[model samples]
Structures are given as structure tokens and as C-alpha cells.
Target: MITAIRRMFSSTIGKFLALAFVVLVGVAFALSDVTGNSTFGGIGGANVAKVGSEEIGLGELRDRVRLAYNQARQDQPTLTMAAFVESGGLDRVLDQLIEGMAFEQLATDMGLGVSKRLIDGRIADIPAFAGVSGSFDQTRFQSFLRENGLTEAQLRRDLRQQLLLEQLAGPIASMPRLATGMAQPYAALLLEQRRGQAAFIPASPFAPATDPGDAALQTHLSQNRGKFTIPERRVIQYALFDAASAPVPAVTDAEIARVYKDNASQFAASETRRFAQVIAPDQAAANALAAKVRGGTALAAAAQAAGLAPSMSGELTLSSYAATTSDAAAKTAFAAKRGDVIGPFQTGLGWVVARVEDITARPARSLADATPEIRAELAKNKANEAIVDYYNTIQDAVNSGASIEEIAADRKLALATTPPLLASGRAPGQPGYSLSPELAPLVSQAFQGAAEGEGQLATLVENEKFAIYAVKNIIAAAPPPFAQIRPDLLADWRLAQGQKIARDKARAIAKAVEGGQSLGAAVAAAGPNIGSVQTIGGRRGELGQDGQPVPPEVALLFSMAQNSVKTLEIPGNRGWLVIALADVQRPDPKSIEPARVAAIAQPLAPAFGNELVEQLAAEAKRRIGVTINKKLVDQLRQELTGNAPVAE
Candidate 1:
């Protein structure tokens, strides 16, 4: 119970949100003396919650707490420790607490046991555990464990169980099968030697005729009413609480000097190095070159004698490796240390030799000088405590059936309008408004929510400051009147005519070229007004071509025959193209298999996670059942820092 509470309460929100679950631990945690460092069921600290003889340890609890803390920091950077504590970082802390104990308990009950060998193998697989020599480094492994507050043995045992629990959930998906016969056209892999002639008669050159009537216009409107409805949109004025706006207290001069002295090494410029390299075929050959380097021969002279490229002595930063940077041939350059004759490091290009001439360290920033800025930053973070409350009030007003204007007035928020929206998800009258970053998604969600008038207010969301929206008015979609749409219809009709005329001309050119007329001759015969023909290379997707990937209809266009002459007639858009297959290159089977496998695995990947969640939930219910402690959850929700009121 104590472990669960600790895990639940860790958050960045101010108090009342977390509701201080810690105040309710019941003194049982204090009296119990076992700290769960080694137990397989342990969390981070002393076991406050126990299932049978198994206890959730302080170490595991701490790990989960740290992970949650880091995540909170990332998700809500302005969160101050005080706000976090108040917002009931404690409740989130508690959620994690309950979740961890529950999952651990469920895994135990299922008789799932992880093996030591598997744990060892997994640890060995980590790149961090490898030494500079590229072998498993026991010293580094031990150091890493110590720093993270874990004993290697304890970590191994827990990791084993965790992996086993995860694996037991099983794979939840299968590969996407390429539909039968879909690859038939693509399999042709045509490489045609084409000598073709074509002319592009720009339809824009001629004025299109227009004679319209209400009857025709109404027909057009009836067919395309999707173009005129007003979108359901809301605008809200939000408060911003920024950390940069906060004032940091000044640091004392003495403190600043002390901080600088303490971190003097940081102020030093890094070492500058000079080295010459000898590219050898393998590590053994590289090692031989290192011996030569050490045996009093100049690195460049030695390389020349060894029948390798004699790279002249050059200066480099300690971190720079030419082989690892721009020059692949100089990759063996990993040998530079203070006054040390280093290397014959093996790289893609071969072996290298280096000598360090000097170490220049960088300057350090003192804590005293930075304290005021830090404190000001802290103050701004604290100031943000009220923003989430604002989102909450706005949401509360909407949930209680307030009108858009009423909600906006109550919260003193803005009510913004969008460009005239269409039923097909477009803003017909505004530039880029049809596909704007924020407005588009916002409009779509507003329509998807609970029916028109009793506006659905979204969670207080913000790119920076907290934001919430109340649907002002939901427009029920209907076709527009024909009188208002005739002009558009005529414009579209004329373009279609022009494309037909242009295509006929292009076909004649293709046929003439086949009959031995020069491309220039065919184009001249088609019309003097024809524009230059353009050739491009592209693959098709739902968006017509990869570059135009958008609508499902367009993607179909890309799948058509490589060189087949096709006319694409989109409503309001007319285009024609003559495809001449230049080449079709199939990817190498072995090289592309891995990429395909990964692509297939991506969507299937999340199923395992979902399965695990469900499995644990089921197991947990079967074992101990759920008791929401609704009061606690509610209290925690009330105090959430980043988004308190919205959750309500």
C-alpha cells in the first residue's frame, strides 16, 4: 500500500490535485522494517505494499518514480518541483505505484519466471556495456549499476522477470500480405528504348466560352453542395505562464567564484592533436603499424615505407575522427591522448596513428551567476499554476451546457471563426486554411463530437499556454443552391474540353513520331502555342504520385502502367500525361528484406503492448480486484498541474 502511494503521488501539479495521498499511509509503512532492494517483486524503496512474502522494494519504486518524473518534466517543462508535488505528482506517483505492484503481482500469480541466462544475454546486448575494445566490459557494467542505485544481481533478476512477463503476452499480429496479382504490372520491369515525339498544348492559351442559367447552376450546386457550409469552430483567449518570464535571484560574487573553481576543468579548452595515419587492411595489420609508430619511426615516414598512403601531420580536435566524419579513408584516426603515442586504431579505411600536442579546456559557467536566472525561471514556473485552472473553468462551463458565447464570456475567452468550410473537409475561401496546422484538426474534431448546439468543448490543450475550445455552432452539411455554383461548373467544364483537345494533339504527335516524324516536326504541326514538354520520374501512391500523396484517389493514379497515356479528370482539376517507361529497378532481395520486415513489424508492434496491458488488467482483477479509491483519483484529478480542470 505504501509503495503504491509513493508511485501515485509523484507529479508536477500543485497541491489539492494529488490530494496528498501520502497523509493516508496509516503508519503501517513506518513500523515495517524491510526495504525491498533485492526482492524480485520490489519497487524502489521499502516495501509499503506486499502480496504474500513478496515486497515491492524502494529501489524499484525509485526507478519508477524517476521514470515518471522524467516523463513529467518532458511533457510539462514549466512544472516546478513544488507544483509537481502539489499537483499531486503524488497521485500519478500513486498510479504508478498501484500499476507496478498490480503488474508485478499478476506476473507472479501467472507463474511466469524469467531466467538468469536471458537476463545476462539482454544486458550483454546493450552497447553501453561494451568496452572501447568492443567487448563486454564488466567494469563499465558495474559502474553503470552503481550509478543507477542498483546491484547488478538485483537488476538482472528483475529484468529477467520483466522480460519474461512481456514475452508471455505473445505476438498479437501477422504480416500484411501483398494482395494476390497486385504486383503483376510492377513485375514487368520494363526498360524501353523510347524515341517518341509529343507536344503540350496549354489549354490556358484559349478563352473558354460560358453561357449559364439558374437551372444549370442549381444542378451544379446540387451535385457539389459540399463547398459552402460554415465550419464549427471556436476561439479562446488563453493565459500563458512561461518560465523565461520568471525572475531569477542574483547569485553572490563569492558563490560564483566558488562554482567556477569547483568546475574549473570545464573552463579548459580541449586538447588539440596532430597525427598521421597508416591504413592497414585489418586490426592485426593495424596493430603491427602501431608497433612501428612506437618503434621511433615517424608516422608519415612509416606509412610511406609500408606502401600505404602517407597522410601528412594534421591537427584535430580530440573528438574528431576523419574516418567517422567526412573522410571515410581516414577512419582509423581514433588515437589521441595527452602526451601519449597512440593508435593503429582500425577503421573502415584501415589503421591510424596519432599524437596529442595539447589539451585546451573550455570555460565553465558558475552556479552563483546562474542562480538568479534559475530562480526567476522557477518563479515563472510557479506562476503557471493558474493556467490549468482556467482550462478547467472553461470546460466546466461547456459541460454544464453553456452556449459558446456564454462559455467565452464566463471565461473571458475568444470566439474565432474559420474560413467557409465544406462537408468534404476543406476551407474553400481561405489561403492554406483548407489544410492549416491547427484549424483543420480543430474543425474536424468539433464536427465529430456530440451533436451541433450543445457544443463539445475539447480538453484544455495548448501549444504553449493552456487552451480549450467550445463549439460555437455546428453546421449541419447540405448541398448549396445551383445559382451560386454555376460559374464554378462552367469553369470546370471548359477545362475538361481543353484537356480533350490537348490530348488529341499529343496522341497524333506520338503516332507521327512512331511513323518517323521528328519530335520538333510533330510539335510544330500540333500548334505553335504548345508549351515545352516536361519529363519527370516519380512513383505513385494514393496521392497520385508520391509527392502528391494525399487523397486515396490520387494514389490509385500512381499505380497505373509506367508508360501508358492516361487522362486524370479530378473534379475542378484536369490533367493529361504520356508515360514512357525509362527503367524499372527492383530492389535487391537480400538488402530489402530487412526493411520490409521492419515496415511490416511497425503496426503489429503496438498490439503486443496493448495485449500486455489487457493481460495485466485481467490478471490483476482475477487476483485482487479493482478498488478505485475514487476519492483519491478525484482529488488527484482536481490538482493536476498541466491540465487540472480539463480532466474533470
Candidate 2:
């Protein structure tokens, strides 16, 4: 009971909204998340909703809904748009869109301004723009913007709204403290239990006596086509090339000599010195310490006498040592001869005194001595330049309307063709087949449409490897022939017919109970196929104890009014359940253990905070004034499912 409530109330609105934004920008490359042509064939573009003076366009709403669906498909691969919409996915997207629009307007009305520097910091923090070194990379950032079809201004506007939302709602939803008295009632509610009587109406016993005609079965199959429909698959022909394939440029000796000459300072004679140093709390103390060292008191002993320890500065060059300490400190330490005491100049650590211990001098290297190092550097630079030139040549070939096969032939590159693959990069009906990592992008682009003859160029592993690909064939998603699936279709038709009969019977039983007939009598009247009435009683929170979700019929008992009966369909069309709530038990607030109450209260605090933020959003909406065009929203949904043409 405690576990369930804690999980339910732990998250704040701030984290929730932040996660929503992350989904939008993080998967910028998943442009094909919404499959099929993006062209809105006929429907005209118009505002779906208006929040304050800002209008929410149909295109924006469509894009957001597609994004939400894509995120959901990560968990449920076969989830359909119809099912997603039925499950309130569209409404959730609409609500989030309306809330964002309201908040942005509210922030503007309040004169809140987000600085460019703050927005830059946020953009830099996004992992999508991070490079191999895990820092912001300008090239990667720009590439993402181009691929996602977003302008810098649009991105900044989104980030600004997000920042404004955080400023407005973050404080209200910050970690809160819930009073023990307030939490006591909630904790006591966990102890409350419900008792009910449940009767199962097995659908199999109610199955049709004979198989339906072909016409009827076909109608059922057509209505439920998504169940039998295969996903679209495509075959791609492609050629790949990597940095290894690029020609290596010859490095002349003159180039190596030039590099060696340019870095003369690096090969010059130099010395690395090590020092023993002590830091004092102040300049006067340091001066006294240095005086002691100069008077034949060893630096370590003098520092120890003053209750400080002497530390060693590792071997460092003049410039390197200056980085660690101050410039003046490094200069003074190096200027002193070996075994000489140097004084009392200010450093970052404190007022310091130091003694030089050792100095190792390195002789200048001749051209022959530096040849190996300089040669390696020049070769690496030449190789990189050659690779860049190679890539540019391939890109230019693609831009000049060369086919994948033609380009491969011209460049002497090897070509490979892929087996038919789904958008998910898996071969349809071939369970054991594994997709090559390099071919995944080829498959994705093929389905999106690689132009005829010319094909498409895609980077397989960023700058290191690339592929030019074109779609060879495409198999669109559709139901298999009716004859091929007749047996399964017949079984489905029978079960569906059985479910309809079971539903009618369950409803009659529920009606009988409402008409003052005893639940057992109602069950008996429904005939022997009905399961015997059984008493069911338990705490509501214990319904999901076996790792599976609570049965809907059982869960409904907790929410139903006492002495009321309800009928619910069993999952998977197995049967129906007639449930009657017989009794309700409420525990006293004083009965809960204080420790448990505290545990429950801790999570409940977030709920209170979330509510405050929700209220803030509601207040924003009220101030801003929102208007929705229901007709356009309905048309947009139709367009999404291809039932209606989309407007430009």
C-alpha cells in the first residue's frame, strides 16, 4: 500500500515537463518517427488553438502528436495511431501544447526575459550536440539543426519558454514538507479495504454453435485489418567508403623539415627544475621564514619549527611552473642557483618561500634528431586533408546526379545490396536475421525515399564512414490474402461473437442485481456456465501484488459505491465479470504507525507541490485566455490516419 502511493506521487510537474522537452529535441534525428508522406495533400493550414494572442497551428500540433507517438513506440513497437489516439495520446499532447503556449504568453506579459548566454548554456548541455570529447561541438550542433529542419531562432524561442516555465513553476514544485497530521489521513486510507462478490461468465461456453459465412468473416477481418497487417519493408542497393579507402598523400622531406624549423623553440635547449617550498599564513610570516632559511636554517626544518610542513614542487619548465604558482614565484625560484634560498613573493596558495633543489638541462636537438617526430605530425595532417578531399569528391558526385552504382564504379568502390528490411532494420518473417550496423541507416533512408537514379548519401558513423544508397524495391504495409489467414480469422470471428453474447449476459445480471435480485440468484438465472459466486475482499493496493496489473473487474470494486454492481470485460476477450460491492471498511487515522505515516507523507509532499504548479498553469491559462477549434482538430486527426487530406 505504501509502495504504490509513493510511486504514484513522487514526480513533480517540473521533471515531467522537462522530460517532455527532452523527447522533442533529443530525438531530432528521428524525423521518420511519423511514417508516410508528410505532405498535407488538401487540407488548408489554420490555427488549431489560440492561447492569448499566439496561435497554435495545425502543423505544430501534428508534429507534437507525432513526437509523442514516437516516444511511446519505443516501448510498444506495434502500437498504432488509432490505438494511441484511443488511449488519450492526442489529448495529452494537446494539453501539453496548450500549457506551453499559456506559460510563454504569461512570461511575456510578466516581462520575463531569458538571456542569450543562459540559452547557450542550455544548448551546450544537450548531449545531442556533444562531440567525441563530450563537449559542445559546433559542427555537430549545426548538423543537428539542419537535419531537424529547425532555425536557431526557433530553437532559442523553445528554450526561452522552457526557462520561463521553470522560473514560474520551479519554486512551487520544489521539495515540500508535509505535516504529519495531514499525512495521517492518507496513510489510514491505505489500511481501508473493500469486500465484494464476483461471478465469472466464461465466453467459450457462449461461443457460436457454427462458423460464420465467408462474407461475415471477411467483414470482421477488414474491420480489424491492423491485427493482420504487415509493416512496410524496403530493399536497398548501396556502396560504402571509410577513411581507410581515402588515398594517403605523400609527405615530402621538405615539409617535415619546415615543421621542424617552425617548432624550433620546442627543440631548444631548456632546463626543468624541482623545488622544496613552504607556505606561511601571511607575508610577514613568510619573510621571517625566508630569513631563517637564509641564516643556514634548512627550509624544511624552519617550516616544521613554525608548525608548517615543506612540500616539493615537481620538475617543471619556466612556463609550466608559472601556471601552477604565480609568474613572479616561478621567476624567482628559477633565477636562484641550486641549493639557494629564495624568498617571500606572493603566490596563489599564500605568501611562500622556496629553496631550489635540482635543475636538469636538456641539449638542443638537431634536425636529424627531430626528424621522426616532425615526420609523424606531417603525415597525420596530410592523411586528414586527403580524407576530407575524398569525402568532398563523393558528395560532389552525388550532387551531380550520379546513381549509387555509377558513383561506385567511377570511384572504384565496392557495392553491396541489402535483403528486404523493415523501418526497424529487421528482415520481415526472418526472425534469425541480424541487421548489419552499417545498413541500418540505409534501410531508414530507403523507406523515407532515396531519389530515383541519383540515390542518397548518408553518414554511417559521422565523418569516419559513409554510404550512398537508393531504394531498389518497396513492399507497402497491408493485410495478407484472406484465403491465407482464413483459419485464424474464423477463430477470431467466433471469439468476437462469443464476447458480444457474454457482454449482453453480464449486463442482464448487473441489471437484475439493480432490480433487487440477489447476486447469487442473478448468477443462477444466467445458467450453469456462470462460475459460482465467490466472496472477494482485499486492500485495493494489494491488487497488483503478483507483478501483473490488477484485474479491471477487481480494481473497479474499490471505486464503485457500496452495494452497487458493475460489469466489466475480461482482458483478451476471455470472459466477463459481474462484480458487486458488498462492504467498505475505513481504518481510523490514529491506527497507522507513525513511521509508516512519515514514509507516506514524504512522497505525498511532492503531490502537493505538483498541485501548486498545476494551479499556476491553470492561472496562466485563465489570464491568457485559450480558444480551441474542435472542427480543425478533428480534421487533423483524420488527416493523420489518412482518412482526410492534409492542408498545406
Candidate 3:
């Protein structure tokens, strides 16, 4: 729960803006070419690439990459910076940056422009700029800019560039319409069917007869060390305490009396009103709806009959309701008595006709009547403060060289130790082990800290609970001793040998079938251990009863040309299968209905638009030449991965 709350909190206003900013920059941000120039060596310095006259600075590249990495980490908690860089994430971000700049340059040269008013509207629409009243606040917007190290001018410039790019590409990439005549062939392809013969060669049947010996097992283990290696683990010592264990301050009657006196405005009488209303496009419709309601027809029924829906507004004070609707509507609704039908007044939404459904009135409370509530509130506040004080005392003890056990003894709390576990809190070699809920959050933090028993404190449940913890031991990730996994290694080696043999046999069968031999005869010739050839068939668009995808082998058969024979390895080293296509049947285009063609064409329209936009981007890049600084790019990658040598 703590981890989940942290993730939720980490998605801040800046992250929200980054998400929307990427969309404004380009639609193909994630789809940027990962296979771009990777040999980083060039004369360019500081800048990653030069798009026309504009340079994409290395700083921008680094910031974008870091932002993207952080955003990606929200979904993938275990994703490491090195792994993200190695997985083409850096390359893709650079490509997107280059492409966005290139397109902006091209659009500018073409005289496309975005107005300041347009940029203002875009900024105002972002919910992050809204104040507590849920309206866009200029102060909030300016503070966000200051926090993100951005000026208003820079924000507008970015917004302008994005809007210009959208104008340049929007029409071409917008909803495209494909004709039925053009879509029939694709529809027919989906209806195409194939029948094939497949024979399974089980790997277990081909296991080696002799023992591979300990030496061979050791060699295999050395070659495949990564597969057997464990991640770094830590033994953690922690002590926990909750609000229930903390002392609450006593509340006196005088204190409660003082609170009521100092905060007398809170005890003032208040009124809230709820209303049922229907908005119409025009005043005539509004008048008619009101008349119908007054004629004893239910407001919901009357509105629905007129092709509208009636909605109930939540109970709100007069000023709040005025802010939500319009002052005129609020005044009319609030003036009427309970169950009164009123309003043919104009609101911000439209012309409104409303019924006063309910009114809730709260009378001022006396000191004695409010005493219980005030006392409870005071007690809760005092308890929270006590918990925080307790937490600080424990933290101070930890900082003063007290071990978790020593601190627990001083505080009179229980001290618990976790088994050596990974950052995810799973004990190595103990799959079923789980940390108690209170201790689970500490493991992640402990793994992030030094393993020298440096004490730290974490608020596990905010003021309600907290834990003090330290890493007791560090277990470096490595492969276990040879004797520890010898049996497992031997079994894996046998499986590997069997898979290799099965693969060879499958290839032989495929070769024989391709060389003008019957699939059944080829399998029979291979050995009696091979499963009998089974006929497999599927339509290209076939789905299982549960709507699952067609099996991979069947899909492969449909993709193959007639008379083609191929071998497919089953997942998990289960076996290999030799597949031979016997026949393919494609439905006649004329047999496909126009409706079917339309259905196929609808989804393809967007794909067609995307292809057109891709072509447009290529042309833009050609016009506004892109030059990559290969050396600096390579340096960036090395820096990100910590592979760069330390300076002397």
C-alpha cells in the first residue's frame, strides 16, 4: 500500500504536463525509429543533432530521456536505468526529438504559425493549473512554470511549435476514408484458409543415454551464468510503531469551550439546496419543458420525451451553486420553496428549467452540543502529534548509533529481522516467503541505501505509523557454488542436448518434405518415436471460442506460400514441430459483401493515414536535413549506463 501511494504521489503536475506535451509534440513519439544511426562519432559538440538551422541540444536530449525513463518506471518498478538505455529507449527518444524539431522547422519555413491566444487556451485547458475552486488559476500556472524551471515565453514557444506541427500534419493524418473497392482484397485475405500437416518431435524422447559428468555441467554453468545468477539481496532489521501505541493528550472542557468561542463562524447557520434541472439549446424549449413539469408530468419523463436528460445538481450553498451554474439560475432556484418548479433562466450551460427538489438547513449549535465533536477532533490531532514525536525520538536514537534492536529496546517495541531478500522482498530460494505488511515497504528502501547498517526512518502509513530500519547484511548477486546446483545443471544440460537433437530432426523432416516427400512418410522415416502427422487448418481471421488468437503454428501455416515446409520450436523447450502447407483457399472477392468490405476498411483508414504521415515526416526530414552527433550520443549512452571510465 505504501509503494502504491508513493507511485500515485510521484505522478505529479509536471508528469501530467509531460504526458500532454508529448502528444502536442508528435503522435509518433513512441513509434520513433529505434534502429537509427547508433555509431556515435561526429564533430558536433553539446548538441545531439542539427535539424536544419536549429540544434537539438544535448541538455534537451538528456532531460527528455530522463523524463521518459521516469515515466516508464511508473509501470515497471524493477526497470533499471542501464536496462532502459540498452533497450533502445535512448535511441527512440533522440529520434523523436530530431523528428519533432525537423517538422517544426519545415512548418515554420512553410509560413505556418500558431497564435498566442491559441497557446493560452491550451495552457488553460490543462487541469494541473486549476485552483482549489476547480478554475484555471494564473498564480498556480506561474508557480508550476517556476517549479519546472520554465519561463512563460519558453512555454509559449513550445506550445507554438507543437500547434504549428499539428496544423501541418493534422489534415493528412486525420480521419481517412477508404473505398469499398480498395478494401475487398484485404477482406478476402482475412477470409483465406490454409490446411497443413504438422508432426511433433518431443525433445524428452531424444535425451542423451550417458551422464554428461560434473565437468560438462560446470562448463555449461559457466557459459550460462546469467541464467543462474541471483540478484543482490539484503538482510534488514526494522522496528514498527502505529498511532494506536502513541499517547493522546487529555482535552479539558475549557479547551473545548475556547475552540468554540474562537471559531464561532463555523457554528453559524447554513443552507444547502439540491435541484433537478434540464438545459435546452434555446429559451422556447426551456419554457416548454418548464410548462410540462408544471402540468404534473415528471421532469425526467418530460425531458426524455424531448430528447434531453434531466440531471440533479448536488447540494450547494447559494454562492457555490451560482459559480457552478449561473447567478440567475441559482437565484431563481434558491428563492423558490421546497418542491417548487422554477427557472426559465439562462445559465452558463444553456437555458435552464429547474425544480427545487430538496433543501437541507443546519441550525447553529450551542457550546454543549458541539463539545463532543470538538473533543474528538482535538484528541485525534494530539494523537497524530504524539505519533510524530515518537517517530522523531526513534529516528534520533537511530542517528545516534543505536541499532534497530537497541532502539526497539529503548522504545519498548518489537524488533524483527527479515531473511536476506531481493529489493522486491522475495527471499532467494524461498519462493513462498513473504514479509509482514508493516515490513514490506522497508525492503525497497533498505536495498536503495548502503548496507553498512546506516539507520533510516520511513513513514509507513503517514502519521498513523512509521518504521525505523537498517540493512544488516549485503549479499552480492552471483552464481551459487558448483555443488549447490549440480543436479539442476545436469537436468538443464540434458534438456538442451535433447532440444538440439530434436531441432536437427525437425529440419531433416522439413527438408525431406520440401524435396518431394510426403510429410507422414518423412516423419515415419525419422523414427517411430515421432508423433503421427496431424492435419492442422485455420482461417486467417479465425478466433477460438473464447476469442483467443489463432495458435502460432496455425498462423504460420496461413502465412506460408503453398508447398512450403518450415520448422517451429515449441516454447519452453517442449519440442519442435515440422509444418508443411498442403493447400490454401482464398475467398472470391465477389463473395464478400460490401458491408464486410466496409468493416475492414474502417480500421485500415487510420493505418493509411499513419503511413501518409510517415511519408510526410520523411519528406520534412529531407527538406530540413538532420545530422546526428554520433560521438556525443555514444558518450551519453555510456554515461547513462555507468560504463564510462572514471576520470583520474
Candidate 3 residue-wise lDDT, 1-648, digit = tens? 112211322322211122225432221112112222222233223677888887766656655565565445444544555666887778876766666777788888998888778998988876656543346867556544543445666566667766776787777766568888878888999888889999999888887866789889889987766556665577888777888777777999989999999999788788899988889999999999999999999999999999999988888898998897778767777789988998788876798888888999999999988998999999987886787667656655754667777777877888788888776677878878878776655665565444367677665664566787878898765778888988778877887788999999999999999899999999999986789899999777664646776777887787788999999999656789999998999999878988888998998787677667677778989999999989878988887665675233
**Residue 107 C-alpha lDDT in model 2:** 77
Q: Give me the candidate number with maximum TM-score.
A: 2
Give lDDT tens digits, candidate 1, residues 407-503: 6555455656554444334554455654434443344334333334554433223323333444444443333344565566677556656766666
Count of steric clashes across candidates, in order: 70, 2, 4
The residue pairs in collision within model 3 are 40-630, 40-631, 41-630, 41-631
Q: How do the predictions measure up, each by TM-score?
A: 0.33, 0.72, 0.63
Q: List runs of model 2 lying over 4 Å from the truth.
A: 1-24, 27-43, 67-71, 115-156, 175-182, 189-206, 235-237, 251-410, 415-420, 430-433, 441-463, 470-476, 501-567, 577-598, 642-648
Cα lDDT over the full model 2? 0.75
lDDT per residue, candidate 2, 285-395, as tens digits? Answer: 998999999999989899999999999988889999888777877888788899988878777788878889999999999999988988888888777767667766776
Model 3, poorest ten-residue lDDT window? Answer: 25-34
RMSD of 3: 8.8
